[model samples]
Target: MKLPKRPKQHILETASYKLFSSKIPDEWIIRDITERDYGIDCYLEMVNDDNELSGDLALIQLKSKDEIEWTNKDTFTHYGVDISTTNYWYQFPIPVFIFIGDISNQKLYFNSVHYTIKRNFDQFVKQTTFPYKFKKSDLFEGKDGVFAFKFHYYYEKYRQQFENELRFFISNLQHYKDFQQLHNNLDYHLGLEDTDQIFFESMHKNFSFLCTYFNIDNPIPKLRDIKKKSREKFGNESHYELYEHDLTEWMEEYEKLTINLIVGMKSFLNGELPYWLRINPTIYNYVNNIGDDGTLPYE
Candidate 1:
Protein backbone atom coordinates (compact mmCIF):
# COMPACT_ATOMS: atom_id res chain seq x y z
CA MET A 1 0.00 0.00 0.00
CA LYS A 2 1.19 3.52 -0.87
CA LEU A 3 0.85 6.41 1.50
CA PRO A 4 -1.04 9.56 0.46
CA LYS A 5 1.06 12.45 -0.75
CA ARG A 6 1.18 15.56 1.41
CA PRO A 7 -1.03 18.48 0.32
CA LYS A 8 0.61 21.20 -1.72
CA GLN A 9 -0.12 23.83 0.89
CA HIS A 10 1.37 21.65 3.63
CA ILE A 11 4.50 21.06 1.60
CA LEU A 12 4.92 24.76 0.99
CA GLU A 13 4.37 25.71 4.59
CA THR A 14 6.79 23.06 5.81
CA ALA A 15 9.45 24.19 3.38
CA SER A 16 9.02 27.80 4.42
CA TYR A 17 9.18 26.94 8.09
CA LYS A 18 12.34 24.91 7.56
CA LEU A 19 13.97 27.72 5.63
CA PHE A 20 13.14 30.33 8.28
CA SER A 21 14.19 28.13 11.17
CA SER A 22 17.46 27.20 9.52
CA LYS A 23 18.34 30.71 8.45
CA ILE A 24 17.42 32.58 11.64
CA PRO A 25 17.66 30.08 14.45
CA ASP A 26 19.15 32.61 16.82
CA GLU A 27 17.00 35.64 16.12
CA TRP A 28 13.45 34.51 15.36
CA ILE A 29 10.83 32.20 16.74
CA ILE A 30 8.40 30.99 14.10
CA ARG A 31 4.98 29.94 15.23
CA ASP A 32 2.73 28.08 12.85
CA ILE A 33 -0.91 29.13 12.94
CA THR A 34 -2.84 25.90 13.08
CA GLU A 35 -6.30 27.38 12.99
CA ARG A 36 -7.90 28.94 9.91
CA ASP A 37 -5.86 32.08 9.54
CA TYR A 38 -6.92 35.17 7.67
CA GLY A 39 -4.32 35.42 4.91
CA ILE A 40 -1.56 34.79 7.46
CA ASP A 41 0.39 31.57 7.68
CA CYS A 42 2.78 32.23 10.51
CA TYR A 43 3.84 34.70 13.17
CA LEU A 44 7.51 35.51 13.62
CA GLU A 45 8.87 37.06 16.78
CA MET A 46 12.22 38.77 16.96
CA VAL A 47 14.38 37.10 19.57
CA ASN A 48 17.73 37.69 21.21
CA ASP A 49 20.59 35.23 21.30
CA ASP A 50 19.25 33.85 24.56
CA ASN A 51 15.88 33.10 22.87
CA GLU A 52 14.22 35.96 24.75
CA LEU A 53 11.53 37.79 22.79
CA SER A 54 12.45 41.31 21.67
CA GLY A 55 8.79 42.41 21.53
CA ASP A 56 8.86 42.82 17.75
CA LEU A 57 6.41 40.62 15.84
CA ALA A 58 5.45 40.22 12.21
CA LEU A 59 2.71 38.41 10.31
CA ILE A 60 3.75 36.57 7.17
CA GLN A 61 1.67 35.46 4.21
CA LEU A 62 3.48 32.65 2.45
CA LYS A 63 3.24 31.63 -1.21
CA SER A 64 5.26 28.83 -2.72
CA LYS A 65 5.36 27.58 -6.28
CA ASP A 66 7.62 25.79 -8.67
CA GLU A 67 8.05 29.06 -10.53
CA ILE A 68 6.74 32.63 -10.42
CA GLU A 69 5.97 34.72 -13.48
CA TRP A 70 8.31 37.68 -13.71
CA THR A 71 6.58 40.64 -15.29
CA ASN A 72 9.89 42.39 -15.89
CA LYS A 73 13.53 42.21 -15.01
CA ASP A 74 12.82 43.45 -11.51
CA THR A 75 9.17 42.82 -10.94
CA PHE A 76 6.96 39.80 -10.36
CA THR A 77 3.21 39.86 -10.80
CA HIS A 78 1.41 37.49 -8.48
CA TYR A 79 -2.19 36.37 -8.30
CA GLY A 80 -4.70 39.02 -7.38
CA VAL A 81 -6.04 39.27 -3.85
CA ASP A 82 -9.36 40.70 -2.74
CA ILE A 83 -9.46 44.22 -1.39
CA SER A 84 -10.81 42.95 1.88
CA THR A 85 -7.79 40.67 2.35
CA THR A 86 -5.38 43.48 1.54
CA ASN A 87 -7.21 45.82 3.88
CA TYR A 88 -7.08 43.25 6.66
CA TRP A 89 -3.32 42.93 6.29
CA TYR A 90 -2.94 46.69 6.06
CA GLN A 91 -4.68 47.13 9.38
CA PHE A 92 -2.09 45.02 11.22
CA PRO A 93 -0.36 47.16 13.84
CA ILE A 94 2.88 45.28 13.44
CA PRO A 95 4.70 44.82 10.17
CA VAL A 96 3.31 42.36 7.61
CA PHE A 97 5.43 40.47 5.07
CA ILE A 98 4.42 38.61 1.94
CA PHE A 99 6.94 35.86 1.33
CA ILE A 100 7.25 34.09 -2.00
CA GLY A 101 9.33 30.97 -2.35
CA ASP A 102 10.62 29.63 -5.65
CA ILE A 103 10.73 25.99 -4.84
CA SER A 104 12.34 25.09 -8.12
CA ASN A 105 15.11 27.66 -7.77
CA GLN A 106 15.44 27.26 -4.00
CA LYS A 107 15.25 31.05 -3.55
CA LEU A 108 12.99 33.27 -1.46
CA TYR A 109 11.68 36.78 -1.99
CA PHE A 110 9.73 38.97 0.41
CA ASN A 111 8.15 42.40 0.46
CA SER A 112 6.58 44.52 3.17
CA VAL A 113 2.89 45.26 2.82
CA HIS A 114 3.36 48.42 4.89
CA TYR A 115 5.97 49.72 2.49
CA THR A 116 3.83 48.76 -0.47
CA ILE A 117 0.92 50.75 0.94
CA LYS A 118 3.22 53.71 1.50
CA ARG A 119 4.75 53.58 -1.97
CA ASN A 120 1.99 52.16 -4.13
CA PHE A 121 -1.50 52.92 -2.96
CA ASP A 122 -3.19 51.89 -6.18
CA GLN A 123 -2.03 48.31 -5.80
CA PHE A 124 -4.53 47.83 -3.00
CA VAL A 125 -7.54 48.28 -5.25
CA LYS A 126 -10.00 45.39 -5.31
CA GLN A 127 -9.04 42.48 -7.57
CA THR A 128 -5.70 44.04 -8.43
CA THR A 129 -2.68 41.81 -8.95
CA PHE A 130 0.07 42.11 -6.34
CA PRO A 131 3.46 43.14 -7.67
CA TYR A 132 6.48 41.79 -5.82
CA LYS A 133 9.94 43.17 -6.50
CA PHE A 134 11.97 45.33 -4.13
CA LYS A 135 14.07 43.01 -2.00
CA LYS A 136 15.07 44.60 1.30
CA SER A 137 18.08 42.73 2.72
CA ASP A 138 17.78 44.60 5.99
CA LEU A 139 14.65 42.60 6.71
CA PHE A 140 16.93 39.65 7.26
CA GLU A 141 20.56 40.15 8.24
CA GLY A 142 22.87 37.21 8.77
CA LYS A 143 26.44 36.91 9.95
CA ASP A 144 28.51 34.04 11.29
CA GLY A 145 25.58 31.71 10.71
CA VAL A 146 23.28 33.86 12.83
CA PHE A 147 20.40 35.77 11.30
CA ALA A 148 18.06 38.23 13.00
CA PHE A 149 15.49 40.86 12.21
CA LYS A 150 15.47 44.09 14.21
CA PHE A 151 13.30 47.19 13.95
CA HIS A 152 16.28 49.53 13.85
CA TYR A 153 17.70 47.61 10.94
CA TYR A 154 14.65 48.37 8.85
CA TYR A 155 14.66 52.05 9.90
CA GLU A 156 18.37 52.44 9.21
CA LYS A 157 18.05 51.00 5.73
CA TYR A 158 15.62 53.77 4.73
CA ARG A 159 17.19 56.57 6.76
CA GLN A 160 18.92 58.07 3.74
CA GLN A 161 15.62 58.51 1.91
CA PHE A 162 14.14 60.22 4.97
CA GLU A 163 17.19 62.47 5.31
CA ASN A 164 17.09 63.54 1.67
CA GLU A 165 13.41 64.45 1.82
CA LEU A 166 13.90 66.44 5.05
CA ARG A 167 17.03 68.19 3.75
CA PHE A 168 15.21 69.34 0.62
CA PHE A 169 12.33 70.75 2.65
CA ILE A 170 14.62 72.60 5.06
CA SER A 171 16.88 73.95 2.30
CA ASN A 172 13.84 75.43 0.55
CA LEU A 173 12.89 77.24 3.73
CA GLN A 174 16.38 78.71 4.04
CA HIS A 175 16.64 79.98 0.45
CA TYR A 176 13.02 80.86 -0.32
CA LYS A 177 12.43 84.45 0.80
CA ASP A 178 8.70 83.93 0.43
CA PHE A 179 8.67 80.86 2.65
CA GLN A 180 5.89 82.42 4.71
CA GLN A 181 3.91 83.74 1.75
CA LEU A 182 0.44 82.19 1.56
CA HIS A 183 -0.69 84.07 -1.53
CA ASN A 184 0.81 86.59 -3.97
CA ASN A 185 0.83 89.16 -1.15
CA LEU A 186 3.84 89.69 1.08
CA ASP A 187 4.16 88.02 4.52
CA TYR A 188 3.21 91.35 6.19
CA HIS A 189 -0.27 91.18 4.65
CA LEU A 190 -0.95 87.82 6.32
CA GLY A 191 -2.64 88.04 9.73
CA LEU A 192 -0.68 86.86 12.78
CA GLU A 193 -3.19 84.05 13.39
CA ASP A 194 -2.98 82.79 9.82
CA THR A 195 0.79 83.00 9.83
CA ASP A 196 1.10 81.11 13.08
CA GLN A 197 -1.34 78.46 11.94
CA ILE A 198 0.38 77.93 8.59
CA PHE A 199 3.87 77.73 10.08
CA PHE A 200 2.70 75.45 12.89
CA GLU A 201 0.98 73.11 10.43
CA SER A 202 4.06 72.88 8.23
CA MET A 203 6.35 72.30 11.19
CA HIS A 204 4.00 69.69 12.61
CA LYS A 205 3.94 67.78 9.33
CA ASN A 206 7.73 67.81 9.02
CA PHE A 207 8.27 66.86 12.66
CA SER A 208 5.76 64.05 12.34
CA PHE A 209 7.70 62.68 9.40
CA LEU A 210 10.95 62.79 11.37
CA CYS A 211 9.41 61.08 14.38
CA THR A 212 7.86 58.35 12.23
CA TYR A 213 11.11 57.79 10.36
CA PHE A 214 13.13 57.50 13.56
CA ASN A 215 10.36 55.72 15.53
CA ILE A 216 10.57 58.40 18.20
CA ASP A 217 8.10 58.18 21.07
CA ASN A 218 6.38 61.32 22.43
CA PRO A 219 7.91 63.87 20.00
CA ILE A 220 5.30 66.52 20.76
CA PRO A 221 7.23 67.97 23.69
CA LYS A 222 10.30 68.59 21.58
CA LEU A 223 8.19 70.23 18.88
CA ARG A 224 6.50 72.41 21.50
CA ASP A 225 9.87 73.46 22.84
CA ILE A 226 11.04 74.64 19.44
CA LYS A 227 7.82 76.56 18.88
CA LYS A 228 7.91 78.11 22.37
CA LYS A 229 11.47 79.36 21.99
CA SER A 230 10.69 80.90 18.60
CA ARG A 231 7.59 82.60 19.96
CA GLU A 232 9.47 84.01 22.93
CA LYS A 233 12.13 85.66 20.76
CA PHE A 234 10.00 86.65 17.79
CA GLY A 235 6.85 87.72 19.75
CA ASN A 236 3.40 88.14 18.15
CA GLU A 237 4.73 90.25 15.36
CA SER A 238 3.93 90.31 11.65
CA HIS A 239 4.80 87.17 9.71
CA TYR A 240 7.65 89.00 8.04
CA GLU A 241 8.83 90.35 11.37
CA LEU A 242 8.69 86.95 12.98
CA TYR A 243 10.63 85.44 10.08
CA GLU A 244 13.31 88.11 10.16
CA HIS A 245 13.51 88.33 13.94
CA ASP A 246 13.87 84.74 15.15
CA LEU A 247 12.11 82.15 12.95
CA THR A 248 14.97 82.22 10.47
CA GLU A 249 17.45 81.61 13.24
CA TRP A 250 15.35 78.74 14.51
CA MET A 251 15.12 77.17 11.08
CA GLU A 252 18.87 77.42 10.55
CA GLU A 253 19.52 75.86 13.94
CA TYR A 254 16.99 73.12 13.28
CA GLU A 255 18.56 72.30 9.91
CA LYS A 256 21.94 71.88 11.60
CA LEU A 257 20.47 69.67 14.30
CA THR A 258 18.68 67.53 11.72
CA ILE A 259 21.88 67.02 9.79
CA ASN A 260 23.74 66.10 12.97
CA LEU A 261 21.03 63.65 13.92
CA ILE A 262 21.18 61.96 10.53
CA VAL A 263 24.96 61.72 10.67
CA GLY A 264 24.87 60.24 14.17
CA MET A 265 22.20 57.76 13.11
CA LYS A 266 24.29 56.68 10.15
CA SER A 267 27.28 56.09 12.38
CA PHE A 268 25.21 54.17 14.85
CA LEU A 269 23.73 52.01 12.12
CA ASN A 270 27.23 51.27 10.89
CA GLY A 271 28.04 49.81 14.34
CA GLU A 272 30.27 52.61 15.55
CA LEU A 273 28.05 53.26 18.58
CA PRO A 274 24.86 52.04 20.23
CA TYR A 275 21.47 53.67 19.60
CA TRP A 276 21.45 55.57 22.90
CA LEU A 277 24.81 57.15 22.04
CA ARG A 278 23.63 58.06 18.55
CA ILE A 279 21.45 60.97 19.78
CA ASN A 280 22.75 64.48 19.08
CA PRO A 281 24.41 65.75 22.22
CA THR A 282 22.56 69.08 22.22
CA ILE A 283 19.15 67.44 21.93
CA TYR A 284 20.15 64.80 24.43
CA ASN A 285 21.19 67.46 26.93
CA TYR A 286 17.98 69.41 26.36
CA VAL A 287 15.81 66.36 26.85
CA ASN A 288 17.76 65.31 29.91
CA ASN A 289 17.82 68.70 31.60
CA ILE A 290 14.20 69.48 30.93
CA GLY A 291 13.19 66.32 32.82
CA ASP A 292 10.53 65.83 30.17
CA ASP A 293 8.58 62.58 30.36
CA GLY A 294 7.75 62.76 26.67
CA THR A 295 11.29 62.17 25.49
CA LEU A 296 12.13 58.88 27.10
CA PRO A 297 15.68 57.63 26.79
CA TYR A 298 15.98 55.11 24.01
CA GLU A 299 15.82 51.51 25.09
Candidate 2:
Protein backbone atom coordinates (compact mmCIF):
# COMPACT_ATOMS: atom_id res chain seq x y z
CA MET A 1 0.00 0.00 0.00
CA LYS A 2 1.32 3.41 -0.97
CA LEU A 3 0.82 5.18 2.35
CA PRO A 4 0.23 8.85 1.74
CA LYS A 5 1.24 11.44 4.29
CA ARG A 6 -1.78 12.73 6.18
CA PRO A 7 -2.28 16.13 7.85
CA LYS A 8 -0.71 17.15 11.17
CA GLN A 9 -4.00 16.74 13.00
CA HIS A 10 -4.41 13.17 11.80
CA ILE A 11 -0.82 12.43 12.79
CA LEU A 12 -1.44 13.91 16.23
CA GLU A 13 -4.63 11.93 16.73
CA THR A 14 -3.03 8.69 15.59
CA ALA A 15 0.00 9.33 17.82
CA SER A 16 -2.21 9.96 20.84
CA TYR A 17 -3.98 6.65 20.35
CA LYS A 18 -0.65 4.87 19.97
CA LEU A 19 0.59 6.47 23.19
CA PHE A 20 -2.59 5.44 24.98
CA SER A 21 -2.15 1.93 23.68
CA SER A 22 1.45 1.75 24.95
CA LYS A 23 0.08 1.84 28.50
CA ILE A 24 -1.68 -1.46 27.76
CA PRO A 25 0.21 -4.70 28.41
CA ASP A 26 1.86 -6.63 25.55
CA GLU A 27 -0.68 -9.45 25.85
CA TRP A 28 -3.16 -6.97 24.37
CA ILE A 29 -2.22 -6.51 20.73
CA ILE A 30 -2.22 -3.07 19.10
CA ARG A 31 -1.48 -2.60 15.42
CA ASP A 32 -1.69 0.25 12.86
CA ILE A 33 -3.95 -0.58 9.93
CA THR A 34 -4.47 0.97 6.52
CA GLU A 35 -7.37 -0.58 4.69
CA ARG A 36 -7.24 1.34 1.42
CA ASP A 37 -9.60 -0.83 -0.63
CA TYR A 38 -12.26 -0.24 2.04
CA GLY A 39 -11.48 3.46 2.75
CA ILE A 40 -10.58 2.46 6.32
CA ASP A 41 -7.40 4.43 6.86
CA CYS A 42 -5.66 3.89 10.23
CA TYR A 43 -6.68 2.33 13.58
CA LEU A 44 -5.43 0.45 16.66
CA GLU A 45 -6.16 -2.91 18.23
CA MET A 46 -7.23 -2.85 21.90
CA VAL A 47 -6.58 -5.97 23.93
CA ASN A 48 -7.90 -6.71 27.38
CA ASP A 49 -5.82 -6.37 30.56
CA ASP A 50 -5.85 -10.15 30.83
CA ASN A 51 -3.82 -10.24 27.56
CA GLU A 52 -6.72 -11.89 25.77
CA LEU A 53 -8.08 -10.90 22.34
CA SER A 54 -11.53 -10.01 23.66
CA GLY A 55 -12.88 -9.45 20.16
CA ASP A 56 -12.39 -5.67 20.47
CA LEU A 57 -11.32 -3.46 17.53
CA ALA A 58 -10.97 0.35 17.53
CA LEU A 59 -10.96 2.22 14.22
CA ILE A 60 -9.97 5.82 13.62
CA GLN A 61 -11.27 7.58 10.53
CA LEU A 62 -8.94 10.32 9.33
CA LYS A 63 -9.66 12.80 6.53
CA SER A 64 -7.28 15.44 5.17
CA LYS A 65 -9.03 17.96 2.96
CA ASP A 66 -8.51 21.58 1.93
CA GLU A 67 -12.14 22.52 2.51
CA ILE A 68 -14.29 22.77 5.65
CA GLU A 69 -17.48 21.65 3.89
CA TRP A 70 -18.09 17.91 4.32
CA THR A 71 -21.31 16.39 2.98
CA ASN A 72 -23.25 13.41 4.27
CA LYS A 73 -22.64 11.44 1.10
CA ASP A 74 -18.86 11.63 1.57
CA THR A 75 -18.91 10.14 5.07
CA PHE A 76 -21.60 7.52 4.46
CA THR A 77 -20.09 6.29 1.24
CA HIS A 78 -16.54 6.11 2.62
CA TYR A 79 -17.45 4.20 5.79
CA GLY A 80 -20.27 2.29 4.16
CA VAL A 81 -17.85 0.84 1.63
CA ASP A 82 -15.36 -0.03 4.36
CA ILE A 83 -17.89 -1.64 6.69
CA SER A 84 -19.74 -3.38 3.91
CA THR A 85 -16.62 -5.36 3.19
CA THR A 86 -16.44 -8.75 4.95
CA ASN A 87 -14.02 -8.72 7.88
CA TYR A 88 -14.22 -11.57 10.36
CA TRP A 89 -12.05 -9.77 12.94
CA TYR A 90 -14.31 -6.72 12.82
CA GLN A 91 -17.48 -8.83 12.94
CA PHE A 92 -18.26 -7.71 16.45
CA PRO A 93 -19.49 -4.18 17.21
CA ILE A 94 -16.45 -1.91 16.93
CA PRO A 95 -15.88 1.67 18.01
CA VAL A 96 -15.07 4.17 15.26
CA PHE A 97 -13.01 7.16 16.44
CA ILE A 98 -13.12 10.25 14.25
CA PHE A 99 -10.20 12.67 14.49
CA ILE A 100 -10.95 15.81 12.51
CA GLY A 101 -9.04 18.99 11.84
CA ASP A 102 -10.69 22.28 12.74
CA ILE A 103 -13.09 20.52 15.10
CA SER A 104 -12.30 23.16 17.67
CA ASN A 105 -14.63 25.70 16.09
CA GLN A 106 -16.97 24.03 13.62
CA LYS A 107 -20.21 22.35 14.70
CA LEU A 108 -20.63 19.97 11.79
CA TYR A 109 -24.28 19.59 10.76
CA PHE A 110 -24.06 15.81 10.34
CA ASN A 111 -27.55 14.98 11.63
CA SER A 112 -29.32 17.69 9.63
CA VAL A 113 -28.33 15.95 6.38
CA HIS A 114 -27.27 12.55 7.71
CA TYR A 115 -30.90 11.44 7.77
CA THR A 116 -30.62 11.06 4.02
CA ILE A 117 -27.62 8.76 4.50
CA LYS A 118 -29.25 6.83 7.34
CA ARG A 119 -32.38 6.23 5.28
CA ASN A 120 -30.29 5.03 2.36
CA PHE A 121 -28.16 2.90 4.68
CA ASP A 122 -31.26 1.32 6.19
CA GLN A 123 -32.22 0.31 2.71
CA PHE A 124 -28.66 -0.79 1.92
CA VAL A 125 -28.38 -2.85 5.08
CA LYS A 126 -31.98 -4.02 4.93
CA GLN A 127 -31.10 -7.62 4.26
CA THR A 128 -28.40 -7.64 6.94
CA THR A 129 -28.65 -6.00 10.33
CA PHE A 130 -25.59 -6.17 12.53
CA PRO A 131 -26.15 -6.61 16.26
CA TYR A 132 -25.21 -2.93 16.79
CA LYS A 133 -27.75 -0.18 16.16
CA PHE A 134 -27.33 2.55 13.57
CA LYS A 135 -27.14 6.01 15.08
CA LYS A 136 -29.53 8.83 14.24
CA SER A 137 -27.96 11.33 16.62
CA ASP A 138 -25.63 14.30 15.98
CA LEU A 139 -22.10 14.06 14.61
CA PHE A 140 -20.52 13.02 17.90
CA GLU A 141 -22.66 10.13 19.08
CA GLY A 142 -20.75 8.08 21.63
CA LYS A 143 -21.36 4.36 21.60
CA ASP A 144 -19.95 1.08 20.28
CA GLY A 145 -21.10 2.00 16.76
CA VAL A 146 -20.02 1.79 13.14
CA PHE A 147 -18.78 4.80 11.14
CA ALA A 148 -17.28 7.91 12.79
CA PHE A 149 -16.58 10.95 10.57
CA LYS A 150 -13.81 13.50 11.10
CA PHE A 151 -11.36 15.92 9.35
CA HIS A 152 -8.88 18.75 9.93
CA TYR A 153 -10.46 21.91 8.47
CA TYR A 154 -8.11 24.37 6.75
CA TYR A 155 -8.78 27.56 4.75
CA GLU A 156 -5.83 27.98 2.39
CA LYS A 157 -7.15 30.19 -0.38
CA TYR A 158 -3.92 31.12 -2.11
CA ARG A 159 -3.70 27.66 -3.67
CA GLN A 160 -7.28 27.90 -4.91
CA GLN A 161 -7.91 26.38 -8.33
CA PHE A 162 -10.64 24.58 -10.22
CA GLU A 163 -11.81 21.41 -8.42
CA ASN A 164 -9.95 19.13 -10.81
CA GLU A 165 -6.78 21.20 -10.56
CA LEU A 166 -7.00 21.39 -6.81
CA ARG A 167 -7.47 17.63 -6.49
CA PHE A 168 -4.30 17.02 -8.45
CA PHE A 169 -2.42 19.54 -6.35
CA ILE A 170 -3.51 17.87 -3.12
CA SER A 171 -2.58 14.35 -4.25
CA ASN A 172 0.83 15.52 -5.39
CA LEU A 173 1.44 17.30 -2.08
CA GLN A 174 2.17 14.07 -0.17
CA HIS A 175 5.93 14.11 -0.79
CA TYR A 176 6.65 17.80 -0.27
CA LYS A 177 8.14 18.67 3.13
CA ASP A 178 7.80 22.41 2.58
CA PHE A 179 4.06 22.04 2.04
CA GLN A 180 3.85 19.88 5.15
CA GLN A 181 5.89 22.41 7.11
CA LEU A 182 3.61 25.22 6.00
CA HIS A 183 0.58 23.25 7.19
CA ASN A 184 2.29 22.63 10.55
CA ASN A 185 3.20 26.29 10.98
CA LEU A 186 -0.32 27.41 10.08
CA ASP A 187 -1.86 25.04 12.61
CA TYR A 188 0.58 26.27 15.25
CA HIS A 189 -0.03 29.99 14.63
CA LEU A 190 -3.82 29.79 14.07
CA GLY A 191 -4.28 27.66 17.21
CA LEU A 192 -6.04 24.94 15.21
CA GLU A 193 -7.61 23.35 18.26
CA ASP A 194 -11.13 23.10 19.65
CA THR A 195 -13.28 22.69 16.51
CA ASP A 196 -15.95 24.98 17.97
CA GLN A 197 -13.87 28.16 18.19
CA ILE A 198 -12.18 27.48 14.82
CA PHE A 199 -15.37 26.84 12.78
CA PHE A 200 -18.61 27.78 14.60
CA GLU A 201 -17.68 31.41 15.31
CA SER A 202 -17.24 32.33 11.64
CA MET A 203 -19.13 32.24 8.32
CA HIS A 204 -18.38 28.62 7.50
CA LYS A 205 -21.25 27.50 5.26
CA ASN A 206 -21.36 30.79 3.38
CA PHE A 207 -18.24 29.84 1.41
CA SER A 208 -19.76 27.02 -0.65
CA PHE A 209 -19.74 29.14 -3.78
CA LEU A 210 -16.08 29.89 -3.25
CA CYS A 211 -15.35 26.19 -2.70
CA THR A 212 -17.07 25.29 -5.96
CA TYR A 213 -14.83 27.57 -7.95
CA PHE A 214 -11.72 27.97 -5.78
CA ASN A 215 -11.45 24.54 -4.14
CA ILE A 216 -10.89 26.10 -0.71
CA ASP A 217 -12.50 27.79 2.30
CA ASN A 218 -11.19 31.22 1.35
CA PRO A 219 -13.75 34.00 1.17
CA ILE A 220 -13.06 37.51 0.03
CA PRO A 221 -13.67 39.66 3.08
CA LYS A 222 -15.07 43.21 2.92
CA LEU A 223 -11.57 44.69 2.88
CA ARG A 224 -12.70 47.98 1.30
CA ASP A 225 -15.14 48.53 4.13
CA ILE A 226 -12.51 47.52 6.67
CA LYS A 227 -10.03 49.95 5.19
CA LYS A 228 -12.50 52.84 5.35
CA LYS A 229 -13.41 52.03 8.95
CA SER A 230 -9.76 51.82 9.93
CA ARG A 231 -9.00 55.19 8.35
CA GLU A 232 -11.79 56.84 10.32
CA LYS A 233 -10.78 55.29 13.64
CA PHE A 234 -6.98 55.42 13.54
CA GLY A 235 -6.48 58.23 10.96
CA ASN A 236 -3.52 57.84 8.50
CA GLU A 237 -2.22 54.62 10.08
CA SER A 238 -5.39 52.92 8.77
CA HIS A 239 -3.49 50.27 6.85
CA TYR A 240 -1.87 49.18 10.07
CA GLU A 241 -5.04 50.03 11.98
CA LEU A 242 -6.87 47.02 10.57
CA TYR A 243 -4.51 44.78 12.54
CA GLU A 244 -4.15 47.07 15.57
CA HIS A 245 -7.84 47.73 16.12
CA ASP A 246 -9.52 44.60 14.77
CA LEU A 247 -7.20 41.84 15.93
CA THR A 248 -5.01 43.53 18.58
CA GLU A 249 -2.30 40.87 18.90
CA TRP A 250 -3.47 38.73 15.99
CA MET A 251 -0.76 39.86 13.58
CA GLU A 252 1.33 36.74 14.20
CA GLU A 253 -1.73 34.60 13.60
CA TYR A 254 -2.58 36.38 10.34
CA GLU A 255 1.01 36.35 9.15
CA LYS A 256 1.51 32.62 9.71
CA LEU A 257 -1.71 31.58 7.96
CA THR A 258 -1.02 33.87 5.01
CA ILE A 259 2.63 32.91 4.60
CA ASN A 260 1.91 29.20 4.93
CA LEU A 261 -0.56 29.43 2.09
CA ILE A 262 1.91 31.31 -0.06
CA VAL A 263 4.61 28.70 0.63
CA GLY A 264 2.20 25.77 0.05
CA MET A 265 1.55 26.90 -3.53
CA LYS A 266 5.26 27.02 -4.32
CA SER A 267 5.68 23.52 -2.91
CA PHE A 268 2.80 22.20 -5.06
CA LEU A 269 4.61 23.40 -8.17
CA ASN A 270 7.56 21.28 -7.07
CA GLY A 271 5.33 18.15 -7.11
CA GLU A 272 4.51 17.84 -3.42
CA LEU A 273 1.66 15.30 -3.35
CA PRO A 274 3.25 12.80 -5.79
CA TYR A 275 -0.17 11.59 -7.00
CA TRP A 276 -3.57 13.25 -7.01
CA LEU A 277 -6.27 11.21 -5.25
CA ARG A 278 -8.26 9.52 -7.99
CA ILE A 279 -11.85 8.38 -7.84
CA ASN A 280 -10.44 5.76 -10.18
CA PRO A 281 -7.08 4.88 -11.72
CA THR A 282 -7.87 6.15 -15.23
CA ILE A 283 -8.73 9.59 -13.94
CA TYR A 284 -5.68 9.61 -11.68
CA ASN A 285 -3.24 8.92 -14.50
CA TYR A 286 -4.97 11.35 -16.86
CA VAL A 287 -4.68 14.19 -14.33
CA ASN A 288 -1.16 13.28 -13.23
CA ASN A 289 0.09 13.66 -16.79
CA ILE A 290 -1.21 17.18 -17.10
CA GLY A 291 1.64 19.72 -17.30
CA ASP A 292 2.10 23.03 -15.53
CA ASP A 293 -0.06 24.89 -18.06
CA GLY A 294 -2.97 22.55 -17.23
CA THR A 295 -2.68 20.76 -20.58
CA LEU A 296 -2.65 16.97 -20.48
CA PRO A 297 -0.04 14.47 -21.74
CA TYR A 298 3.00 16.19 -20.25
CA GLU A 299 5.37 14.51 -22.66
Q: Point to the candidate with the largest TM-score.
A: 1
lDDT of each: 0.53, 0.36
Local accuracy of candidate 1 as per-residue lDDT tens digits, 1-299:
99999898798777866665665655567787886467888887766667777676778787766765554455675654556677888777677877777666666666677666544544444345555554324234355223323443355345556656555443443323244333223343333355555664565466556656655542244555655665676565634323333343344444444444444434333342222234334433333332122222342
TM-score for each prediction?
0.49, 0.22
lDDT of 2 by residue, 243-288 (tens): 2233323333333433343344334323323222322345445544
Q: What is the C-alpha RMSD of each candidate to the true structure, in Å?
A: 15.1, 20.5
Q: Identify the runs in model 1 with alpha carbons over 4 angstroms from their true place.
A: 1-3, 48-52, 68-72, 126-131, 134-253, 257-299
Q: How close is candidate 1 to the true structure, as a TM-score?
A: 0.49
What global local distance difference test value does model 1 have? 0.53
Q: Worst lDDT window (10 residues) for model 1?
A: 290-299
